[model samples]
Target: MNELIPKETPSLPSLPETVLPALDRLVSALGIPRTVLASSEEIEYAWRDLPRELREIPAELRGELIARMCVAVSTGLFDGAMNYIWNAAVLHLRNKIRTFGLPVVAQIRQSDFEEKHLLELQDSKLLELCLKLNIVDEDGFFFLDQCRDVRNNFSAAHPTLGKVNDREFTTFLNRCVRYALADSSSPRGVDISSFISAVKGPRFNHNQSGIWVQRLNETHDAQRQMLITMAHGIYCDPNTPEQARLNSIDICNGLTNSFTASIRSELINNHTELVAKGHQDKHAASLQFFERLGLLGLLNESEQHHIFSRAVERLWTVHNGMNNFYNEPAFAERLLEVSLQGAIPETVHEEYVQTVACCRVGNGYGISNAAVKYYDQMIQNFSPREIATLIRSATNNNNPLGRRVLSGGSYRFHFRQVLNLIDPASVPNAVNGSYIQLMR
Candidate 1:
């Protein structure tokens, strides 16, 4: 039957009488079936597609493997040709990786990436390494990985499941060339060692910081996140130099707004762990680190309370010290800014209300003229509950805030002006008598 399986080799596409004469004689003597090879039609089809595909490869890449592949194609051995072409593509990929700097790969991976390790990597793993280092972009990785699968299932490199047609072979070869065999001139991985050194070394002026920021902009997300988290760690380290902290903050402020949710969660975890471990100095610096980035809202209420209470205590201490008038304005302004980040939490309610009252009523000498405006602004923003506390405390004899107002004439007048800042309706009914008395 002409349509029978294997189709009696002569019925398949014919090969030239002169071609493979010696091999044909040897196979005939050994009783080997010609059907074991691809048909002449398949070989012809492969040749038609081969030249166009091979030309796309860099001329330098088409050396021994390309030559062997041509031999295999002429002999109608598509499997062996697939093997040779894949080998060429893989060899090119490896060479490209070497050019991309293994030291930088080690840094991005956060592990050592020596030459031997690269050499010993299996094909799939080599592709994975390229993906992580961004040697192959997402679309490139997707297609190259498919080509690897085709090579494994249909190539001579392994026990192939079955044969592939010429069109399938060309498609596989095309993908390998397009994705893994491209020029390696573009990707430059971020070097972790020099990155850490630059961040910890000198302070960054505009152009200096801009250069490093540009470098980070070109890297992929994984390395971007790692570097940002590293910068946050450096900033929060209690033992870091002030200038290093400044540099780290500069780097983080540039990157934080673009942070993925994962990065934000990681930063929150680091800050919370410091608090849980009672690393007081790190916790304090971490607070400022969050504050400087305008991320105070990312912190929990308890952390916000601590920041508020501590800021108030510092301002109160400096307000009573010898250089009170000269030193108080900056601290007062910072406290006002921190308050605007979130609502005052209940944990620091008393101190928050009374501290502003104390600074407003002044000491035995006089109020800080430079600090008074910030205090007046804070007074105007106090909630009804805080207003109630402020009014009730002025009548309590044991309260330092009350004692200050009761001590002198100018104190009483400044306290009255502070009370006038509140809308009458915002004052609670229970504290109405105390409020009226204070305003008078």
Candidate 2:
């Protein structure tokens, strides 16, 4: 019976005399129950995990935020902690945006925020703008969204019917520290600025160049874009020294290689999603992505081969009965112009030739013409055996598509000439006579 007596909960440590008025005012203004204020023990427990940099947050708002968070956690007022985190995160993001210069701030406000009402945006809108500006990546944006949801649904600011828990509040608080406050350093932006200055000034020595390349390789996708854009600016500047321009070009090429590799990986990994979206959408997306790279002059011969090979594979495998091979013609033409002749893998080349042989008018608007043009451009690079194989493949059964491709078109004379050079014996006497007549 004695052991059955209930024990009283321990009281929280008292607030300092100086801070008591502020805490009382905050509770009154926020309209939260005084019981939400935490014990000193609870505040100490939560403080252990607080980021060091968070303590450096400016004195004005930081004190209020820290006090509220401690109270909220100690008193099981998770919603109050969430609200405080949201305010602090928004303030941090706004400060970061202002540091990016007026041009960037104006651009984000115009594009992502309302022009006249930009200042009126709340936390969620601010986070959305940060996301669009690449100030925050997707995962960071997601956590911020969760914080917003919890604040809106469970905090004292709203009329909540349910309560949040300690785990939820702590998770949101850690994310705020990690994604919002921690990002204030801007080291990546500084590195990009330094690299641009180096590239614009003079040619880098071997060691310097090696260091620059390594840094560029390690950057995140957003930073990679900034580096590529800066390189392009240097490459296009007429006053740039030849050595500097050449170095910029090399950097752009390497970055482009990284870009294309990631794009290829994505295509491979998301093939099912792309297929469900239909080939037209997938083709358009791929072409636009590669074309942007090409315009930057980052699409190298090897990358062209890679993209063309993938395009050919999709052409063969995916069956869109509408017969619209969207963007194939443009891609093939670009591949022809950029790809190093004779560098295509044997398997890819074989598939490409076969694809062209089976071509019809609607499969892609100008695909047949593009394929024929590529073959003509690359004919000289073909090995004698490859040329012979192509001639045999085209002429066997008088392949109508092949015949159409080779007979009296833009590449007709060139195809005939290559045929005569590689394997004259394979060219029938009638075909040779017609070629001679066409030449006349």
Candidate 3:
């Protein structure tokens, strides 16, 4: 019978001798039940796992609340320990936001943000603000939010929704420490208000602009994407001041090398939204935004056509002006560059093909030699639709570019070269007859 008796459950580890006794004396003197706190056995279980979390945090973060948490854990008051952890975490996040700057938060949130508001933010709102500021990343937000819920429900901050076991409390501690406490040092937020002022002010020269670009590089990826899109929106706003528009695009151009697919998708969505709402001025501005950023490939075919057609019209008008050769290359080259960004939209295939041929073939006098390569490169990539447009245009002798092809000499000779540049495979069966006529 004695041999069949159960053995005792071994103790894990212990805290200071006086820690739980002092708490017991205080609670007993206050006539409180000892059972209100967890058992020493439970405390031992929870405390064994605590050191790993405590060790991972820096010495500087082990402040008053952290010390209080240690005492709370030693006294078997897991609720109080978590409450202390949560308080410490909240203060750390607020300090981070303060260091990031209130004005910048005001700018991003589009509301009056001050120290008073920061102090007054409720816990849930505080978490959301941290998420928005990029002070807390997405995964951190998830875990921290769970911690906050646990702190409210199971910790001593409020009446218990349900009791948390030693294991549950330690798990909460790990999450709070790892996600919020341990990860606090990285991902500094940008002061977007001052940043916006700098961008909208006079202008940023290369050195001046490079400084802002460097500041962006120092921040988190999400915030960097946010600022990039913000710059795009400012550039696309119809009422934005001219210098500001120039400054906005200039800043974006610097960050162009680092653009991700996410950033491209965001810009495209904004452009598409404006177009859908028939916000013509902003929509047109957005197309120019993508064009200037060399991101036309992100735009849909319709938007690209809109961009190309406008570009072609502007250049064609310039090409027909006085000193056409000297005055035309810059605008003509811009048009050619825009076409190269993506496939020429079929909607403007006729005008697009004719404009390039006209610029390449020149008028009665001479061509802009600076623009010849741009025109030639654009001609060489003509799709079957575009090749057909160029050929079909030649059949209409009364049209401006068609008239140039029929006038013979260098004009007709240049047209023949343009036809030679087109891939015969690209010529559709429908336009093969016209293609043969032009080639001959």
Tens-digit per-residue lDDT, 268-346, candidate 2: 3443344456655443443434344453133345445566687666554432334435435554555455345335555
CA lDDT of 249 in candidate 1?
Answer: 84
Residue pairs with backbone overlap in model 3:
none
Give the top-scoring candidate (lDDT): 3
Among all windows of 10 consecutive residues in model 2, the one with the lowest summed lDDT is 357-366
Q: Please, what are the lDDT tens digits per residue for candidate 3 over residues 1-440?
A: 45753323334356888876877898799999877778777887888877777865666787899889887888788888989999998998898888777787787788999999999999889999888877887888998998988888888999988777789888888887776777547555678777888988987788988888888887767789998888988888888999999988888888888988888888888878897899999987888888988888888777777788889998889888888778887887798778767777778888888888998888878778888888888888888777777877888887889888888899988888778787888889998987887777
Global fold similarity of model 1 (TM-score): 0.62
Report lDDT per candidate.
0.82, 0.56, 0.82
User: CA lDDT of 172 in candidate 1?
Assistant: 83
* Tens-digit per-residue lDDT, 292-357, candidate 1: 887888999888887888898998788878889889899899988888777787898888889888
Model 1 is weakest, by summed lDDT over 10 consecutive residues, at 4-13
Write down the TM-score of every candidate.
0.62, 0.41, 0.71
Native-vs-model 1 lDDT?
Answer: 0.82
Candidates in descending TM-score order: 3, 1, 2
**Pairs of residues at least 3 apart in sequence or in different chains that clash in candidate 1:** none
lDDT accuracy of residue 399 in candidate 3: 84
